[model samples]
Target: MKFDKDAWLLEAIRIKYIIPREDGTVWRRKWISADLKSMSREVHLIKQRTHKATQRVYFNLTFKGITKSVLVNRVIALAFLPNPLKLPQVNHIDGDKSHNYLKQPTPELVEKWGEYQLEWSTGRDNEKHAHANGLKTGRGSQNSNAKLTAPQVVEIRASAESPSAIAKQYGVARSTIVNILEGKTWIHV
Candidate 1:
């Protein structure tokens, strides 16, 4: 059976949201409870920071004496959105990683924006969304790290020349040429 993370989260954590103040900053308050009623403690938001590599906002939370770093987007999704399909990834519909609130839109907001900001998605859907939003540069020429253009990859694949000869001509590693010929990389092109 598939493990239900939301169900486990509901039993493990009770999250409470504080209304935004005049400055328009929403405050998220987490209440750790031993039982649903009596024993509880409030803790300040800890180590919340934008990840330098992915540029996604995240924070560390302690659960059962173990500290885990979790993305703020996933936390917001877990708190406010429903994932009936149990998709393994949460996509930021607008491609803004810092905008982590997964609240439903008001009628006025819907009329203006037309869609929710977050949704459950498969890994492929998430990748597609990122590429569609220009957040990800896909394989081949579109990728910043791509050494060869699509036409060059095609030429390399069609060439009967040795991998070393092709690599020297393209100024890339022999393994790169070999991989291209072997259909290991640049499969999209």
Candidate 2:
């Protein structure tokens, strides 16, 4: 089936936990345990909050006596859009993970918002898009684990030392030295 290029698509089994409406509101599906005598299946709107560690909005639901936390974006995708192609991931068009909802969009509004806010994508495609849009960091000297600073990379490039000697001097791998010399890792320098 053909869907709007920017439409939200559901993650697998999303319907079992939450319903994302076009209005951008997510409803938690009430789950019932077969063995429990007093379980009700009435769905209710979910109260979302930022996860402390990840700072992403999420809600929790109980299913078969077990509570599961679900991300808001995943809930939204599962509520709208068809996935005949069965792509495995969702892309936020503007690259903002926080823009998952806007005052509860109607299906029409959801489709419209999606035109500028959502798409189905693979993890690789999502990462490439993030990098292209400068939303992702950790490149070059900006990486927390970087052993060399930008100035050091520039000096390494300009140095006349052999790759092996530079590797020893910098306490880096020999391949790193080779890459620096060949304009591979530190291309910006």
Candidate 3:
């Protein structure tokens, strides 16, 4: 199966931030279809590498006159995978964002790497999968910006102080205190 260019174009049109052309098409549609004959061709030629911040495999591809970073997994999924449910997010099953290919050591590679899997997933399911795989770190005391320790979380749970007072004492928001009190966060502890 081929990438559904029309579906992508229509989705792009739904974004309010995109500036529309005089012909009623958005900027994304104009450039995405301008010179690109097939997505597969562009995807194959581009050098695949991992983004440092995102850990996702991507490559820069020039469309019309604009060069943009294209995600390898999304391209491969759109081109080859079936998404009957039209799920919005693409998940790397093994928690390795750089692992996007379905087959090991594609024709482009001489050395064999194990097959990487991908699936169409909803936003919530994608997050659950990431947490399950330890890919995400924004939960509990593992969060880099977390102010409270596990002991503090326990103390907060046991405190009878008003939420505002507890928040003030801990230098955090009242909502944080409330969430802790209600057991909305810091679940593992």
lDDT of each: 0.66, 0.65, 0.63
lDDT of 3 by residue, 1-189 (tens): 976543553343343213233211222222234434422212223356777887877655444454466666776665556789989888877676766665444543324323446778999888777765677777877898798988899899888899999999999999999988887887656
Segments in model 1 whose C-alpha atoms lie over 4 Å from true places: 1-8, 14-37, 40-47, 103-113, 144-189
Error at 155, model 2, angstroms: 19
> What does candidate 1 score on TM?
0.58
Residue 142, candidate 2: C-alpha displacement in angstroms: 3.1
Native-vs-model 3 lDDT? 0.63
Candidates arranged by lDDT, highest first: 1, 2, 3
C-alpha RMSD between model 3 and the true structure: 11.0
lDDT, model 1, position 126? 83
RMSD of each: 6.6, 8.7, 11.0
Per-residue accuracy of model 1 over 124-143 as CA lDDT, tens digit each: 78876776566777667897
C-alpha root-mean-square deviation, candidate 1: 6.6
Question: Which candidate leads the pack in TM-score?
Answer: 1
Clashes of 3: 0
